[model samples]
Target: MGPIRPTIADVARAAGVSRTTVSHALNGIGKVDPRTRERVVQAAAELGYRPSLRAQRLRSGQSRTIGLVSSMPVAVAGGPSKLGFFMEVAAAAAETAMLSGFALVVVPPLDTDPPLDALDIDGAIVIEPDQDDPTTKRLQSRGVPIVTIGPQQGMDLPHVDLRAPRVGRLLLEHLREQGARRIALLMGSGHRSWYVDLAEVYARFAREHDMPPLVVEADESGGEETGREACAELLEKHPDVDAICAAVDAFALGAVRAVAERGLRIPDDVRVATRYDGVRARTSTPTLTAVDLNLAQAAASAVELLLANLKGTEVPQVISNPDPRLVVRESTRRG
Candidate 1:
């Protein structure tokens, strides 16, 4: 019905080289001479030749493929989860995997068992697993070499995470230095490592300071709405609150709006700070102060660690990124 497409054999013949040589040149595999590779490429172009990706994948199997999965659901049409942090992490991980010469397939969170066999993956990087995660269980049962982006409470696995205690201290200290007397925290009710570690540090800080801790926990996934409600509740209970440290950027941004709705000026009436230097934090009114967790670096590290695990080489059980810097902005500063 249509013109017969050219094949590798045709390109090889036209280039006056073996099929193996053509494969090497096309795939950028082994050491092929620069001139020879050029010639082969030219031949393929002239002959309108294309190699079958399916065939190449069948031959390589899981040897050249890896998987990236999230414990949270990602939009089917888009790769990112509800949280922008996860989206940034996934993008960084994909780039790292490409540079490492491996194909990465992102699998969305599902309640049923993942189709691991059908996926053809040698190893996997879990974005952030829960304390009792079924996906983690399935991967472990299948003996998949696994690494995690965020650490968990119970599961022991290779992971890369921020030092939350150190990060928390920096935020609190910044607020206090700005003359905040009664500070409150707005956070998620989740038990993920990030939230858990922050809560621990907050508790310790409260005990040491001999000040009563004020924390408001809610479903942070609702982004600004959750922050608004949580901040409103906190303010109603503690009207003397002079500072707020929100763990999520959306929460911090919403807190800014909430303060304004109540005719309060940020940094003057209520200083505001949060974690994760994303668009919401940077672009919010007064631009909320936030901690730069080095999201891209952390995500890339997860891929590299997973790559090491796939190579059967021993890697450190845990890799913690150091000194997540705090980015100060108008929300926590006096004009």
Candidate 2:
């Protein structure tokens, strides 16, 4: 046979203390004198007393951990801008997990094939997963519960859809509220679907309210220069445009620069807003007004959904629709 496992009673006896004191010292609960706690720890160490994580998990019926995967495309400041948003998601998920007696393990995309067999997570949350991604398909096949952040194209995956069109509507409503009539839309390339939906929503809102459609397409050349050129061209093309709703924050910043170059003041000549609430928006010269999607809350909810599935809790095909809150700031409040 193997060596017998030491127990808390063994530790207490070795430390010449009651079991309650030993328990208190080990769990950091209630009160135990400092020296006594230290002595208990020393005794436990001497006795090779190891707390049984497995036993604890069995008793609690929880793995006490979550796995997080970010399938975000690796592009230099691309449409997703994974760093800030994904980090917020992970951090908030970790905090919520810890509160509910769990931990978070962030797994970046594997260079080789993803090995589901090697992963021992209770559940997972996939951020910005592509619909046709094989890794995601494999994970789902393994009965590992998952929640996706952005919209998935074809797969029947549970997700919290970030309504891109609503983002446009929010900005339109804000601009309208601020008495903006002529609005211009700044769109990025490759994400044609998102911008198209946004344009559709903007047009519907404008037509319903009897306003002119100001849609301008910007080529995403993966550089600030292209964004600057696009902004300048659009501004020159429509000097009387009172507001701009950009698809992303960086492009919005570029628009701000273009507006300033024309010797026109922000909000006075051109108000601007974007869908993302990020550092670029916050640090812009006139602090852009954006729709705060509350990514943290969304992440937490996704994780909870994953955990529910992991627990065999009849995971409902839930669709989380987080409303976008318009963060009113200097950029768009006056126009």
- Estimated TM-score for each candidate: 0.78, 0.69
Report the lDDT of model 2 for residue 293: 87
Q: Write the per-residue lDDT of candidate 1 for residues 1-335, one digit (tens) a residue.
A: 98898989999999999999999999999999999999999999998888986797788655577888876532211222344666677788889999999888877545455676677677888876757666667877888888887786688889997777888999988998898878898887667787788888888887877768999986744667777888988887789999999987777877888898888899899999998787677778898899888888888888889888877778887888767998999999897
lDDT of 1 at 23: 94
Candidate 1 segments whose C-alpha is farther than 4 A from its true place: 1-63, 71-83, 106-119
Q: In candidate 1, list every pair of residues with a backbone clash.
A: none
**Whole-structure CA lDDT of model 1:** 0.81
Residue 236 lDDT in candidate 2? 89
Q: In candidate 2, what are the lDDT values of residues 158-242, reduced to their tens digit?
A: 7776777777888888887887788877776653335557878988998898777776666554444555668889878877888
Query: lDDT of all predictions, in order shown?
Result: 0.81, 0.75
| Per-candidate RMSD, Å | 5.6, 8.0
